[model samples]
Target: MESERYIRQTILKDFGLKSQKKLTKARVLVIGVGGLGIPVLQYLNAMGVGTIGLIDNDVVSLNNLHRQVLFSEKDINKTKISVAIKKLKKQNSTSKLIGYKLYLSKKNALSIIEKYDLIVDASDNFPTRYLVNDACVILGKPFVYGALHSFEGYVSVFNHKDGPTYRCLFPNPPKSEEIPNCNEQGVLGVIPGIIGNIQALEVVKVIAGIGSPLSGELLIFNGLEQEYHKFKINSLSKNKKIEELKDTYELECSFDNSSISSDAFKELLNSSTEIQLVDVRTTEEYNDYHLKQATHLPLKSIYLNHNSLDFEKTIYFICQSGVRSLEALRFLKKEQPEATLISINGGLNEFRNYDAKH
Candidate 1:
């Protein structure tokens, strides 16, 4: 009976009935239901993970359907957790799937994370990623982390028996604009598919104590070049102490203050003001469908093309998500301190939602 359930995986010499049983007994928490979270959650459920918790505050969107396979066009505007729970339950009725439809914040991070055997950081932003890591560290729970850029992806396991935390690798977050998010730069749908599936595999390894987990090692994949590289994460600081998980985690991820909510800027957009609406997303994103009258100046070009902006107008930056637009706002502020600028709270996601409702 067991062999038939995990027939393919159990065939491997290292992963037999014993490992499969371990998988069934494990409880996993997947944070985020986006590109990475979808595959991770799918495989875990199929593998018969006894219980799984999914946390996401986002709703399904047309853009997410390309990569987030668990969702369909009909799922548009539905909460990610609700959709995931419904689909995953159909995939494996035996597994208990719980959905948390809220963003993971420091306030409830520890309590929510403490119950799970493992935490998967499929979160896109730095703030939440670091928050997950610090919470896992504090709770002594192992977590698998995966991040993707345009064509590249990184995967690592943190807070394992002796593994390094996310802080050890990225001791400080880079300047907001220095690193572009997947929204601004654009990601091949398959990139996260490849990386997130790998993360799910790693989670199985950790649970079964079978194959060597990615502990103390970082795996990097370049989809464009089809090259794979593994770097030894220095374990020299393994004994280092973890004191607190706070907004400081934001510093490590290089998040800037300029990132604001679209709700906060909605009033600004409605005012009888000649505001310069800047689309920091790529041309492809802008062409697909963007705010009316928004200028298509990609974030990467903003630094060198600051003169293109009309300082006289109230400048408002926007991106697929708020991340890149915030970076654009930062760049503008540095060049023209006197210029007034603001970032749409949730960027295009919020704008599109508001448009749909109205």
Candidate 2:
């Protein structure tokens, strides 16, 4: 270890050389390389965390540049984990960086997560968050959780030393339509950075055995109002009983059954003028690029304007990725249960790929 490099932090009275040594012995795994993950990784690695592992199957896209600051225009389309690992290595050569360029699913979550001393839930979606929580509970590991909404962010440390798990706060996952993700309801660029840094702080505190970790209290930050709020979360005995991974953690939504491949959606688009295709991405995203035949109806405004959609025809929903479209389908399914609604699986990215090929 380079003592001089971390001398400033090591010099603190409460966090002396002993705490620095603890940081060096820590092994942390971050679940995403997106907005929140970037800051968490940067701080932990710089602070002398001995080993860090990151898993992400996503690629850097033009849209990701706004929040995922570690990536640049030149890195677009490159695998996130590979790009992150390469850049992080240059930042701290002494810290070991491990990259798993794969989505965290039941098949791989247990095996990979077991190797790390701490897990950071930096993922955007609910499915991955739940998967990480259950896996950590099963393995008796602690995980720092962070999530983003419009201009708001939340941070909490779960399953730490018999503390409250995520399920204690949220006993069950909300219906897809009840809560849209940051993708559906756009997030301010700085939100993740603020929340991620807090997560990093909690990680250091947990590893070094100093300061109170956010184990039972959920920290909520509102960037717009510049406000911070904390709510206590009590542990649920049932949540800690998770012995094994669920058969499947996929969220229940109509989109699962009513999804069509991009190729099939394209064929349907070409075949029928009667098909009502709606783009559920933000107006900016729709303005940037959208199918000429698709109507722009941002997911954030879908509930208010859903009645405008024609129930007589089979409506197809599309977004940058399949997530928002699935959320849209779920919303419409409740509003117009009799109407036929379909989601374009893989969304515009897959559509653009097939379009480029053809």
Could you say which candidate leads in lDDT?
A: 2
- lDDT (C-alpha) at residue 254 in model 2: 21
Give the distance in Å from residue 130's predicted Cα in candidate 2 to where it truly belongs. 0.6
Estimate, for each residue in 145-235, the C-alpha lDDT of model 1 and write its tens digit.
Answer: 9999898999999888978888788865566678778888888999999999999999999999977899999999999999999998865
The window of 10 residues in a row where model 1 has the poorest summed lDDT is 247-256
lDDT of all the models against the reference?
Answer: 0.83, 0.87
- TM-scores, all candidates, are 0.70, 0.72
Clashes of each: 6, 0
Residues 95-204, model 2: lDDT tens digits: 99999999898779999999999999999887788899999999999999999988899999999997899999987666566788888899778889999999999999
What TM value does model 2 have? 0.72
| Clashing residue pairs for model 1 | 173-252, 173-254, 260-345, 261-345, 262-345, 262-346
Worst 10 residues of 2 by lDDT: 247-256
